[model samples]
Target: MKHAPRLTALLLTLALLAGLLPAASAAAPQPAEPRIAADSAIVIDYDTGETLYEKDADTMRVPASMTKVMTAYIIFEELEAGNLTLDTLVPISDFAAQISRNQARYPTAVPLPYGGSLTVDTLLRLILIPSASASCVAMAEYISGTEAAFVQRMNATAQRLGMTAQYQNCHGAHVHYLTARSQAILVREFIRRFPQILDYTSATSATFNGTTYPNTNQLLPGLAFEYEGADGFKTGTINAAGYCLSATAKRDGRRIISVVMHSDNNTTRHTDSTALLDYGFARLAADAPYTDTAFHWSWQAVEELDALGAELHPSGEQFRPEQAVTRAEFTAMLYSALAADGQLPPLPGPEESTQPAETAPPEDTAGEPEQPAPEPEPPFADIDGHWAQAYIEEAAALGLVEGDQYGRFNPDSALTRQDMMVLVDNFVELPEANGLGFDDDGDIALWALEAAARTTAAGLFGGSGGRLFPSASATRAEAAQVVSRVLELA
Candidate 1:
């Protein structure tokens, strides 16, 4: 929570940039780049590894927590190899626990209760979200029996990825004399090894157990150069590393990777990442075969006319795939698609729009045509009377709302840390939140698992009852508490 001040500063930076820029100016900033605080920066097309821009990129500097990106890659590979699964719980070793409790320059492990058990999936979430040092130590120990072995694995992976200038220590804490060139090479090597991980770095915000913590890398959000293609990588901070980031984004079927190290603060890290992403996308735009759309739909649009309540039509025919989509339209389309897919009930007709207050039929019902079945109650109505209902509706219209079993939004329900996570997860695209965290598994409710992970990661919610009560309703007070935190981080 102490990061509030830093987050505020970052928002101010974003606002100033937005106010000064024009929509048509998504192009990369000009060569007269502002005098920035970064020690190193580089941008390359992920598709061809072509260097788009570089400034002291080859100089070696502290890798800082950006080292976790490599650590995560190793963990992911192990998971893919069947060496690990979300359910594999690991105990905290003395050394790992020490790291977890160690209040290094960054906050220590989010106070994981001593000797507590956590799953590999959850461990990764903690590592990616808060850059929880203990989570990393615990994970390394779990995988290799010791941090030493884990470091060995990290260095081995580095060699395989062609990070010739890079090396590693047991804990990823910065060490002596790692040059900026070495850091850039390490980042390039990482991109070559786990090209798909861009998804994690670009996440704007995530929730873990109802607590939300935003990605320190501001570029993922539209705040930085309108990064429509931006998705993920990682962010880091330490006197040794300053502020560091490895960012990845896609556009027009092309992908680009950018790395910045030793930046001043939230402002510099954000601006540097933006400049790199901008430069990368600019090259692709110039090389495009023609004017291209930034977005397109993969699923067909459903258009209901009658008993054909569940209908599917080609995206281009029934709905223009090329047309930009509003949040409301997108959500409605999603709900309609789910209905067609049997995931949700059909939309209510005018005659069936309202539910009767009483369950039993009226006394005169015998003489009347059988009443049309009541339309499903709108989930959001339950909270209409709740304070902040307007804000909730705004979130819902943006597809940021969550619902209960009976399809009620339950606005008055007291929000858990996990609920906040679920809400943020869907509203923003963040790969790091996907199936990450100890409490997230098949047996757990999908919404709960997602919410717990995202909110926890985003620093919004903390779990209650040893688990996330996703079905629980949220109270106005509780919702405001969490929403205020989110807005702060945002």
Candidate 2:
């Protein structure tokens, strides 16, 4: 037991980023394997493409409004290739406006101005957030001369993403058929590739030129069946589709994508999704490496950090929760936790970045002129030698950390609570907060005080017996706690 071979953690990154293998954090009272009311359903882990649950996933059924996800995917591809910009105007064609005018004839259509145009961005919002069939037709016409051409593209893209489907229309009205697995794969790929689509799908409501549009997905925030952390994808309901839905949510940095097709009603669609989501989370919780934190106060936090990935601690059996964490360790943990939550710092500007500029494709085969790569940042003198070096350096590259004015990272020094709060401030905008009312509030470093107060109100920091040890070195446990709370906030 003494020489456990550095415990490459068959437990938490001792909760580090390799992911808490074996859910050594173990199952937090998991629910039984879920049984759904839908005829076809599937649940998948967003990161690893692991199948967590499924039922008749390959059987074909009507897609209904779920087709908008495919439309949105094609639109994102256009945007990425610079073929279309958010500002690009898409004139509502007579054909599209005609459909929207008859909500009686076409129940899912939004009332669009037949001759007037809307921006590509606004149209996308209408299509995804509200599942507006008219908007979908408008975009289809703008992208292709006719809706037929856009349908061809959707089928081709579906084939490329390994989805099985026969797409009849942009809005899934003409009796579209897609397997539950295909829908899940479509959503997984959509999120993996164009997560920004969430900006629309997650919206509870949107105001168009003169009217308001509410999202059809009931699982998102401020809705009938609000599931916490649930954000995107689409919902489909029609006589043929029979209440189909594809739902996606993120919790503790792990994302779950679920698809339920051919449920009896709206209630069953959401309930089945909830069951699948619950089962998927429980399954994930029971996953990964092994370690016990000796039932510390930070057990939950440690579990959360471990959930981000594998750890590199020398001992798998013991996490040394009371150990005073070094600067490198804290920053590395923060980096992993934030990344798991998909909270990456924004990319540097073109002038400062080596990444290619977001330029549109050229008219001919002549490709973009290559730009010279930027110079590599000089290594932090005290950084490279640390085991957490890669994580620390990555954090530094994102401007999430910096060396002391002396150019030394001082990686080995103990991280005080004051410093921890300051580092967190770099990523999260601390909302205006009331006084923390900690006995040691006045003792906090002046620069860190405001951050401390804000974080305190955020419940990212807490006091014991009305005292916050501002200058005290944060232990591994405390750091884990802080990171987990930040994950919740994100």
Candidate 3:
């Protein structure tokens, strides 16, 4: 009996040891968490094919106007191959002209008559800035001698990038036959091909014939005017495809290209893209060698202030450019600089809050219970702050937050969750928030709650157990961490 028990104990010991040994051997170092900036987003090193971060990156959804990225790719290749030039003028074909008139599914043309002449550069500008379907068709015809052939080239290029699922029509309208997986593959392939598209995407707006065409990606201003290290790419929208954007930004010698598909609208797209860009610039490194200072760019700052200005110096001293800025005040500084630089247009007059007044309660009578005072709002200053400062100040200037009546930035004030949610609410205009299952969604006071939920669902912010602690104060670390977490979720 003693021998039998000993043998049983030895067998159990052997089995336990065997199980642990494999687990120990297979254990590898945990990989660093990926940081992403948008829902269904991706950041790729412009030079290398390495993916820095991804969220539903390979999930195929309609790319809407992002199809222009591939279109721009072909155009750029044509330019590089001497088939097209910035100044080269091309006649609009009947097919291209017809597509531009397509108000049914794509952006309508600006009454460019058939056979009207436009330069290749001008066409590029149109497609890139406002995502004109007419320009896309014209460029397609210009490249492949016909839209059919141009699509063939686009698909071939997609195949080269290992995007097996994407197929192109003259415009990026949905093909009933392709799976979402295929569409994503094609989009990813295009990204892999010309990472340089990001430079163009980051551009705030472009000028043609003395008229400035702003980027459909509104984050440009949201991040601040003439954002340093910012360039250009494009934006896309189709009712079926939702709102989409591909953005590229460079900072500290690192450039990241991010794509957001099926955003609810341009505002969501910008927030998502800004989140991704923030993460990439703050975290990742480019494969090519460079230093942090190379990514830095300058924005002009003015010291003047009124209701929207308070320069928060540690010792109440005059403002210094090198001092760290809070995300809120930094937005103001960037706008100030943009105004100085002539990048942003003149400011608009004070209007009632952009928030839905219908949702607000009627003013209380003197005898009634006192209503809570509304939070203060920021001045929409269009000055300049470079890169990081630009994003911060831009957020402020947009009335995404209320800055102190004085111009000083209180960088260390903890951001209340309600405040952050309110900032997000102010940032976007969404459809009515009801039947989404949150009671707060129906209330006017929870506007930020509604906005935050929408953004969160779009993968901009990861919710905590489906609840946003709106009353909690947000720390800088918490803010960055949340932003980073949201980037990863995106």
Candidate 4:
């Protein structure tokens, strides 16, 4: 493949803009906004192809082991095209075995015994899950007869995917120019074409040849800092590249892909990735429209409640469709909506202090002063002077919300999807379970199973791809829509 000089110039321009080149940083200080520790980072909505957040996203940097994502992509394409089968055994070359054993810098190397053999599927798993560099080169040679030819294919794939990256090696040992944006795009395409790759990326541990290799992507299950709904992805590290990661997650029917390149350290890569995922979810929620859309079925109900003069967000004009609703905020919105329909009593005003003013101790009863009524204890220790204190207390009084076992209502925490269903069950009579089969029914918390069934039957919530993500947090707009649906049912 012919390397483009223009690509080099573009990379140089981005490096200068990001203050990545030594001379560029020496020229001036970097900008302050979008403060991330990574040299290049980006978060994009997988479904809509929208970039939610970016910081030096286009800056060219070494991809390191992230090149395996492309390698796996090509392998999957080959599999689908009938060029390779999972059972096809690839002979372990002496060079592949030497690279695996000698590469002390790549800690994830798996011993590929020379004169032995392994299946294409197993090697692909090693390349993806543990990011084994030996497996990468072995697969490269097996597919194209030479690493040079495989490098050509990698560059061709990048070009076909509209990525402006330059790959010198198939295994990503030396410096290879790739941007965070290009990585995200590659992952997006990979997911679009072959979502089954998640099986490899999401595996917590894989056993091969009597050795168990843990996946390097720490966000997967049974690892430190495991994120809810996290599945497949990849992580990379090299002296030159620092720590890099390309992660993807799905929650509540929304999917996001994030890439962090050249993080300061391994821990920082995961932290940066977690922050990017949070930001992506927040961006999706913020960009979620209140009017007609996929959630458009709730549009009329929202409008109906609006017509009834029910004010959900007292501080905002637009209904923030994608923001997570806090426990206190949901309580307030529910109380107000119920009050509007007269299904619940009007919200009480602030109570006056029960302590009577001192009026000379009431001279007639000076010898027997009346005792003042004891003040009601605050509902939660955390909400003493909070703005939502009144709403929270009233909700507790009405039995709409019960404090957790710790005797504290975590008022500021995001209300969960299942918890929203249980809260709705308190006021409305939920329909019987209509046998709406969900793939994740067994994963639902025991306490939430009944509510999940009833809510699904009542049309209050639905499954995504046949799986009900019971633990996913409910957004502010989702809460409002559920409240509107409840009002209509009433």
Cα lDDT, all candidates: 0.55, 0.78, 0.52, 0.76
User: Which rank order by TM-score, best down to worst?
Assistant: 2, 4, 1, 3
lDDT of each residue in 379-480, candidate 4, tens digit only: 667888876776566556555677788888888899888888777776566667764588888877888778777878888887679887778898876887
Global lDDT for candidate 3?
A: 0.52
Ranked by TM-score, the better of candidates 1 and 2 is 2
* Residue lDDT tens for model 3, 1-490: 0011111111122232222211101112333544433446776655344566678776667776767767787888887788878899888887676766677756734334586789887787777776777787777777777777988887787777666445567556543122223343444454556555555655566675566766776656454323445565566677776767766656654556777777776667777767666655544333111122113321111212211232222222222333433545433333332333333323233446877559778776878886796633323232233323333433344444454566644544545655555454444443444323443333424445565655555444443565555555553333433333332321
Candidate 1 Cα deviation (angstroms), residue 451: 53
Best by TM-score: 2
lDDT of 2 by residue, 1-490 (tens): 0111121111212234333222324434445779799999999988778898899999989988898899999999999999999999999888899998777545576788857989999888888877788888899988888899999999999999999999988887668798999999998988888888888788998788778878888898889999988998799988988998999998867788999999999999999998998888766665532334423456556755676562424254556778887787787777766665667643332344678877987566457797796745544777655777667665565566778878888887999988998888765766889548988888999888887878888888887899989899998878877888887885
- Candidate number of the best lDDT: 2
Stronger candidate by lDDT (2 vs 4): 2
Q: Residue 385 in model 3: shift from native, Å? A: 50
Q: For model 4, what is the alpha-carbon lDDT of residue 205?
A: 83
Off by over 4 Å in 1: 1-37, 105-108, 176-199, 206-210, 222-226, 288-490
Runs of candidate 4 with Cα error greater than 4 angstroms are 1-34, 105-107, 291-490
lDDT of 1 at 189: 58
